[model samples]
Target: MKAESETKNQKADSTELDQSSFGLSALNFKLKIGFDGKRAANNLTGLGNYSRSLIEHLADQFPEHEYLVYAPKVKSARQIDAFFEKENIKLKLPKSGPFLWRALNILKDLTQDECQIFHGLSHEIPLAIQHTRIKSIVTIHDLIFLRFPQYYKLIDRKLYEWKSKSACKRADKIIAISEKTKEDIINLYGINPEKIEVIYQSCDDSFKTAFPKEKLSRIKATYKLPDKYLLNVGTIEERKNLKLVVQALKEVNEEYKLVVIGKQTAYFNSIEKEIEKLGLKNRVLFLKNIPFTDLPGIYQMANVFVYPSFYEGFGIPIIEALYSGVPVVAATGSCLEEAGGPNSLYVSPNDATGLAKAINQIIENPQLQKEMKEKGLEFVQKFNSSVVTQQLMNCYLSL
Candidate 1:
């Protein structure tokens, strides 16, 4: 009923928003491809990771083609700098200020570079892209701003809707990160279902690597992580439902602490007040500056991973946890089920007590933890790099 109302509201206001090539030997053409790599250079959150990982995997799997990463100028190179330095992948930068150039003038550069296909890694393509001969594809991550308007500023919401609608109308095909997002796009923008493709996003390959016991201990010591902690990773905001997990912590074992790592937002002040009110000041810990390389080791050390977000295009932290061999407990609504698979536990985002029970159910049973770890690893194989990258290549080739 809530989703229905949200869909109706989005309609009244009206707006918008695979895989690999089969055989390398079969597809004989080598073409130039461009990506909206601005986030690849500057942002450090989900979108940044998505842009960087997708480009790297595609380059590795389909080495025959040229990969062009079009990013605005950055002050300094980031950790993913080495990944982009591959032989076939070249970084293209803007000559002027990033904003207008990225939105408008980048099309001129795209034509000059002779890009056969230009992909918007985030939620937009160049506004005038359809005028050119190059094919375009845009990946729509989610419609949270429209679905839950209370969390976004008025001007920001209007801008996002306008940009997403324009990009959807202009692009040759649309890629949705999850089926949930696909549904939102169709419901809100009235786009045809045939034009959209759902390609699941995977975690960084680092998460799948098993760190040595010595290194796990070192990372644990360096981060000052508690011996027993419940992990949650995502931006601190109203939509992520971090307070629900904090409330759930009040009922779990006293030895267990809740560890959170994400970019902070103004919503954190309410969380601090909630913690103080519940007398859990020492029970919650926040790590702000965690290095990207060390994050998987941190995940491997947790007793359990919890992601009680109210909504998501896809809850990526769940996949990271599953790959890290940790048990997962996530909220029931949204696309978390798609990420956690069949064995991991789930509770409603509104049910703090239910969430506590689910966490304790796994923590108190060692055999269950082993089973979940084994089953989760087996399940997440569907999102392996080979399978996902192949699907992505197919999408580009189709266009």
Candidate 2:
């Protein structure tokens, strides 16, 4: 009797889903999708960029589908106002409260919204929603905390590991940003490789466009940029290994300056100490709070873009440099090669001398620089928004 009753219930649930899908199809409507936009709404780092760009591209490619972004708080109207203006996109903020309350509110909203699919743009999903019928997907950017435990506090690493492991197990589908990330997920978590989808992310479209000469000149003057400089962008964190670039500066020609952009952390103090010790105080410039609109011009004006990070899921800065028609010199032993492509030069992460040589090679050889620029531009086409969006859409449709 128990088996017969369970079978009946399963059949009923299957019929219900079929009826619901058919009803939506009849109405010419697509699945209602929800995204965790905490990073998208507040942070401007790689996770935030990924969240924003994915949503923008998905909306542009598939306008018929509804997108609901759930966040703890909507901090800036300007940050998401443009997205809200679109008919198919809506921003859902939690009611005033603490973390648990806000999380419960978001879960309630997801259920009430009747979201057919809920995508955690980062490595998290509401535990409350696991019982719901909503299909869950999570994008696991990297396992950096697991790989480099020393770089993170014990408690933080434990928290991240728990969240990531739980999300990978709970998600109906896993989106890995790179092949390296996908492999890490499989090996670390023992997840079946078939369950994960690899999708590459493109930088902001702004990088692909060129600013007028007068505007570029104005930006250069406003920033007080040198005539020629090697550029490095990313937060001032040890994992980024920016000290290698500073060390490389000691070996490079005196006329070649090094410009570092991105937020400064405690690590900046150590890097500054090294710069002073090497007598490169004036030659190495550290910039903070650079306007987003000015980054493309800065990349275009660069003699070479150096990314010596010890590891990454995918290097957006390299792609940005590629889009901006700049030669790239990135480190090996991670996904940087995938980001920099075949034409860009790569050196060992800790090899300051090799980095210096690569930078000088590009700087002195105009032909090599032009070749890298051309090849990178061609290589970057595979990551275009239209291409990536379609791949993401296919993942959604499969579910």
Candidate 3:
């Protein structure tokens, strides 16, 4: 706690350093941006991961320009400073309004901050904000609300649909995480293709290295993972289509287990029932809320990583598994193919028999695994954080 406090104080002092000369440098044209980081703890999903990764990389790479992180009620000044405590980073106080407190607060702060550009990492943007001068960028991760509307609750579907459409319409620039998603925005949302850019997300650097055998062993012991288990990483939600994966697993009973790592959602009862019906309660394990630091070890322990989600913005875990040197088997449709490229074995998303066969084929063949790993590594280079950061910086410049 004391260490965290000291770090917070250091950040407070650093931000006090001169930001008056911000617009002078070419890097300053990179822009001072705001994002909804307030969704860190409670409602965390893919958006939270996207927000955290983008903010950390932006602050580290662009120290000359200013970054104003907007959050609700500053709870732990330590957590805020740890993420955005650099010389150019500043934290604005939360504002109150009719929408959720954090949303309302961020909406209010845009009027006050001397930012050149603003980014809504999530789908929603402050439609009421008097954006008379500053340019805005909103990242529409995917148009899942339109594509998979039945998966979401009615209220959530309506809210996300309204906000997503409004944000795309209002922003000066839009970022789609994949080309598939970019097409979805242009087709489903009727946004112009020229206005949007496709920037893929990268796996963490830690995943690229071979985790120490001892570390892998420790994680394996903790989770009781099989000697050669298949891995799936994501929130256990309805849209993730884990029931299909479970069905696939039942047909291919081997020495391996299907180990799932993610938080279980409220609507996952049907999946649970499916697992019970398949008699896979012992074979399929759901390990929820594992820390990011621990994920590389888990990935390293797996023989093959599988992500059979029906849809995605960009499947970070697919490449993450690839980088960890685990062979990947993903569904043919959606962004998994984009992430996995030619290397990954892709089966139809809803085909339990095909998915089962793919998993078994990878298990039986060692050479296939080696080929997939090498091809995955080659494809992963394009989406490196450094490369993606430059692309993002260029987008900011364009804005």
Ranking by lDDT: 1, 2, 3
* Alpha-carbon RMSD of each model: 8.3, 9.5, 7.6
TM-score of each: 0.90, 0.90, 0.86
Scored by CA lDDT, what does every candidate get? 0.87, 0.85, 0.76
lDDT of 1 by residue, 1-399 (tens): 353355445433321112223333425768899998888877666677688889888888778889998888643555667766798888889755577888888988888999999999988999778988999999999999998999989999999999998898889999998999999999999999999999998888899989999998899888889999999998999999999999999999999999999989999999999999999999898998898889999899999999999999888899999999999999887899998999999999999999999999999999999999998988887677666776687777777
**Model 1: residues with Cα > 4 Å off, grouped in runs:** 1-27, 78-80, 95-99
Q: Name the 10 consecutive residues with the lowest summed lDDT in model 3.
A: 15-24
How many residue pairs clash (N, CA or C atoms closer than 3 angstroms) in each of the candidate models, in the order given?
7, 0, 1
Worst 10 contiguous positions by lDDT, candidate 1: 14-23
Per-residue error at 247 for model 3, in Å?
A: 2.0
lDDT of the structure predicted as candidate 2: 0.85
Model 3 lDDT per residue over 108-210, tens place: 5676776667777777666654355767888888888789888878999998889898889888888999999999999988998999999888866788788
Model 2 regions lying over 4 Å from their true place: 1-29, 95-105
lDDT of 2 by residue, 252-294 (tens): 8888999999888899999999999999999987788887888
- TM-score between model 3 and native: 0.86
